[model samples]
Target chain A: MAGLSDLRAGFDPATVKEDFTLLRNPHHDHPLVYLDSAASSQRPDSVLAAMDDYYCRSHANVHRGVYRLAEEATSLYEGARQKIGDFIGAPDPGREIIFTKNVTEALNLVAQSWGRANLRPGDAIVLTEIEHHANLVPWLMLASEIGFEIRYLRLGEDGELDLSRLEETVEGAKLVGVTMCSNVLGTLVPVSQIAQAAHAAGAVVVADGAQYVPHLPTDVSSLGADLMAFTGHKMLGPTGIGVLWGKAEILDAMPPFLGGGEMIKDVRLDGFIPNDLPWKFEAGTPPIAEAIGLGAAVDYLSGLGMAAIREHEITLLSYAMKKLEADHGDALVIHGPSRPERRGGVLSMQLDGVHAHDLSQVLDSRGVCVRAGHHCAKPLMRCLGLAATARASFYIYNDESDIDALSDALGEARSFFA
Target chain B: MPGLEDLYREIILDHYRNPRNAKELESPPALRAEGYNPLCGDEVVITLLVDEGRIQDIGIGGQGCSISRSSASLMTVSVKGKTLEEASAAIRSFKAMMSIHESSLAPAASQTETPTAAELAKMGELAALQGVVKFPVRIKCAVLAWNTLSECMAKATDAQP
Candidate 1:
């Protein structure tokens, strides 16, 4: 964990442990050890308090208001954009950060906007085989509407995207959309190379960063992504707030997604002109509270440092993989990248003689909470030739003991059915 | 060895190791139904030989968890040769004994009398699985096969008119 310790910028893991309000189980008598961060990250108390403080004192609708409360709220909202810009490596102008409801909407915005404007009939869009439905469905819909061809970048034997074929796939393609880190397989893709290659071919690169942002420091400029989408909930922030970082020129040209308040500069009987840059895309009562919450979440993550978070996660992930392979090798099969740094914290596995659901039941009884399902990554599940898998993911608050609990619970599950 | 006793009570092992009347028959006279638990991926296919509103025979097919498979075996042995109303009454009694409520949980079953162990065993070694309900996930596993029986009967009645 030395690498992780260094990345945390000296945020001592032992001393910096804060109270995560969501970890407290209201229903269970036992202290809940949550291992499902991929599903939703639990919020620390500081983040909750920030939102509470905002609502209590300075909560007001941002932009277009003349009063002091509105001015302060607007500043906070814009400040959040800058914070996100710094957090995600979008420092050119925080105005590049266009807030949406979630990653689903951000991806959809790009699909409906950029896709509609740039793509021509007979052009092709290249997507990796493991794209989450959020990334896949939008492009698929746009392709069908415009008669653009859709192609997939195949997975290698290890389920990682075939880097050998990425260059060829991006050649002459209109756009390339891929996940920075696969939600199910946890394979970290080489976005920089893909982005450079796509640019060489006059193609745009869009990265789905929902799984990547929480585990690593993602810089939009360094990533070379023309567009990227990520959500707050997955990063221990509030839901209903997502960010889409795109080059300013791309956003200026793309069509609007939602209509009404704040998105337009002037309304006319004949036509309404759109607002400038980021506001042009934001429409109809943006998620003010959630934006404030996300700002607070950014502060929390920054204090701990992304490198520290990444390092700790890699340590925990390696520990878990080793434990699963050593202890449950006969009865369980682990899936994902072999190297810890090449993936996020998601671990998918199958237990012998026990269905994922039944195993989860026994685990739940023992006070272990894990997800057992398709994980909304149906395409990836199909690629793996599995209907579902039992998953155990980790975040900052977890340690070696959580892995022990998972291993013990897995043994109990096997015994219960053996 | 933990003994099959840990998972499949002696009665469940008996049913699973030797399923009774485990065969398919002619289709038109037989009422067929499928039961599925979407969350767990357990599925059951049941066919009943109903003769003049009486279950002349009952059998099932499909693969699932241990509790579900064992429950199917017991259900086949228990419901054969019983009148429609009698089988219905037993199912009701069985569901009530399961001690569940429709208001809170989705797709609730509603027969009100809690059947005793003797009554469940009369339904055959199905009583072996009462222990499964204690494990919430297994409750659905144990009930998947029984739910198919109720569907088969219900469809059989609707077809009669």
Candidate 2:
């Protein structure tokens, strides 16, 4: 509901850039033009300060100690869970959120825990062709072990999911996994619609919100996801922290993914009873400082306003697409949905005469940081008939000037190769 | 802080544009091996015919970046007429120039052990890829072809009497 005018009034990239120390420092000759938020976003000073404050003042192993410092650490760690849950509109914050290494771990936890418990030899799980390796591999690994059928929804020419066979694919599927946004194509998928179809077919929907949660406003319940996975680092938080949010009953029913320390209620030599909802899944020592950092990132993002951030990115996407098309014409191709509103701020592009790696190398020399690889979505890359793509994904810190720098560098790269 | 000029030399670009032996040979007569830089999905397939302990023919296949394609071209040309041992020596020598010493476990060896001028003289046009040593990540691109060639050579010769 937030307008572009609100974006201009409140959110300013120039002002935001001042908060990141790395942005001020030049990579070589030019200041760092980071457009790789989809891989991982740059952290602001506030997130860094939060982590530092935690390490410096209140560092302790969470949940066990009766001391005030340990209690404080536990509170900070649990408080982060609450804020992140609220940020994503989880129905039950304390019980539904499970901390993992990253979204990859989070997805694997779901596949190992809920999937192993539910899946059988005759069962089938529906997945999309455009899922990142994180989403696809876990399910594939699980299916390979359990000998269940895996059906993939095909991709359309316009980079959207081919949902014509959605009903057929989900007909007897136990679970349906879908990415909310394509990291390579920047395509924004209609999760709610997919969820509706999946639900109608009596299938549970597991959403990959890695690319979506960072840029768009997310309400997991409204989105109709039974369970979801997203990472902290891609949303201006530190690495080593990820989140998996599921329905309370679903998480409660599932067995523990990993068992060692904090995950159990009582562990005898013979058997162990798992702990309550969230902690039941969190095994061993958790990333406490990283969680606090994520809390700060959530606070920062909330202050900026998710709607305004989305609007800012939309404006940036429109500008960049128009400029690139006008400048390069047929020589350059941008994948995914043509309409700016239909996609996120990610641009997966190819130059006619140059390979993506070479193009990215040239851009790197110009202090532009775009990812030039399969983007960890090799199946999607293979589907697109590309070995790799030079991806430039925008974040809240990026502006039109960064896009201009990209355009200029692309021109230079083309001529240099030519 | 190596510049783009260091990574993409004119010779390297020339080889990339007009690659040598960029084809696949028939499977019965030629042995094939493939290499992949999983980081970028850059793949190189090497097919070669071995006869009387010498490489008779070589072909390059698969798709990759300018560096990888060109390196494959250069590698195919360099080892086409050499014996298996000689070709492996060339690979070792090339890897050495890239500061990947096979024997040393010390991390400092890669940084400190620069290829000598004598070693560079023996490498010919392949020496141009010495700049890749300065950029650690692209060394995989430069060496991808050699690695595949080594594999193909091993399998081809092993299949013979």
Candidate 3:
């Protein structure tokens, strides 16, 4: 079987891991084994340097600056937009990409601006059972105000979406909000297929690509999503910057989400003329340094090649799964698809009688950092009949050694509890 | 050994493995309050049986981590026979022991000036949880049951008259 060694022929995770200064944290006696990339990935030196360079060299608020330094800063920020937009295959980079605080804000922008204008009373918005609160809560909040019925696409016992009743679920739905990948379960939902179904049902497809875009090769055109949201931090970039990619016409049609400086073309005494497609949405003086950092992150990922990155994760995930199952047997139960090919490098594991909190504490002693909680998916937690699970997620920087450390820690935790 | 052992003390593990009053009290006699740690998905339900300004009986029913479940178990045992005022004092003392701030230790503020063996004995087994202050994130888990108990008492008081 192709493992990390076989797949990462030229790519060295150790070398890549070294670029991230946080990975070398001296707080623990043992080496830090960070497996919580699904939450927010650590930024590499290149990303950090890029942001630092921006602040040192081109320190100015974007969009309204006329000075040379301001222009340079604007170029750096917008240039990032173009690079990121191209990286994700946004149809029109200049018009489609809107920057927000994070994926949560991006999703909120869609819910508040697009959803409010389009949705009516008794209109349905189709959402998956496994969506993060970022994707789920916005629509729910909007529904309460707009009086639209929210329908959920339930997950099967196998942890994948039960799409057998897709047509029935999307019936009378105006918008279908779903996650491209499950952060907790690591199950990869076929976004393109879901989008096709949603489109056929006369519903717009809005995808939360917070998890997917980081690991997978994303092409918005092929995915057929009307709008998609993802954060920079999860994709090896800095926090406080997120991307909301939408169709140009759709973005142009929607009202400005927040009325602030850069988002306006003209503010009359009576009413205001909203800015063009993308700017109309990006209200405030955006995360300039963070966006530049995101641009550098994109460059780094492009250098590594997204396909190879995906392959590396698949190889590592498969190895981890096999090793864990062999070592622990019935003691450790992994959630999501049995096959690693069908999932990302996220393993939400349950160690029989050991509480996730207890397991996390024990693991922390060995310098293995894993998230232990409902993973902001309370609905999915209810579906799985679990209060919480210990989630160990991986990224391009992670390899088999980290997984081995994780397994060893889990064994120790089990013994300690026993 | 100091850190991990301090966190998962034997007493805490004992309470977690074998919880006290780990069942729902009959509704007519019990006033119930639910506590949820949304971050960890720890849900604790505390039921109180108050009789003439005293805690006649208490029951804890919930699903949570060892810290939370064990805390609930210990809380039920500690407050069972005490008057509401005394139980509240015990709660205050336990909270003081787990508190990082000097202000939170208001009830036993004078004890800080001179550490007495008597004050230590007053806390009893709840002193096992004093180590929890080190782990700030898990402190909420240790207090989930106590917070719920406070809510249950409030509800019971509100129901009267």
The TM-scores of all predictions, comma-separated, are 0.83, 0.97, 0.97
User: Of the candidates shown, which would achieve the greatest lDDT relative to the real structure?
Assistant: 2
Off by over 4 Å in 3: A1-9, B100-117
Clashes of 1: 4
Residue pairs whose backbone atoms clash in candidate 2: none
Model 3, B45-83: lDDT tens digits are: 878889998999888887999999989998888999998
Worst 10 residues of 3 chain B by lDDT: B108-117
State, as a TM-score between 0 and 1, how close model 3 is to the true structure: 0.97
lDDT of 1 at B5: 43
Q: What lDDT is reached at residue A2 by model 3?
A: 31
Candidate 1 residue lDDT tens string, B1-161: 12234555867755665666677666767778888777655668888888887898877777565577777887777678889898877675555546654345544433343566677666555566666655655677777777788878888888876
Report DockQ per prediction, comma-separated: 0.19, 0.88, 0.71
**lDDT digits (tens) for residues A161-215 of candidate 3:** 9999998898778999999999999999988888888999999899999999999
Compared with the true structure, what per-residue lDDT tens digits does model 1 show for residues A1-418?
2335434435543343447755654425555767888888888787788788888988888996899998888888888888878888786555689999999999999988888888999998899888888999998888888899988887886657887877778888989998998878888888888888889999988999999998898778788889999999988899889999998887777888788888999999999999988988999878887888898899888888887788888888888888988998868888888888778888888898676766776777667888887777777776787766788888877777778889998998887666
In CAPRI terms, model 2 is classed as high
In terms of DockQ, which candidate is stronger, 2 or 3?
A: 2
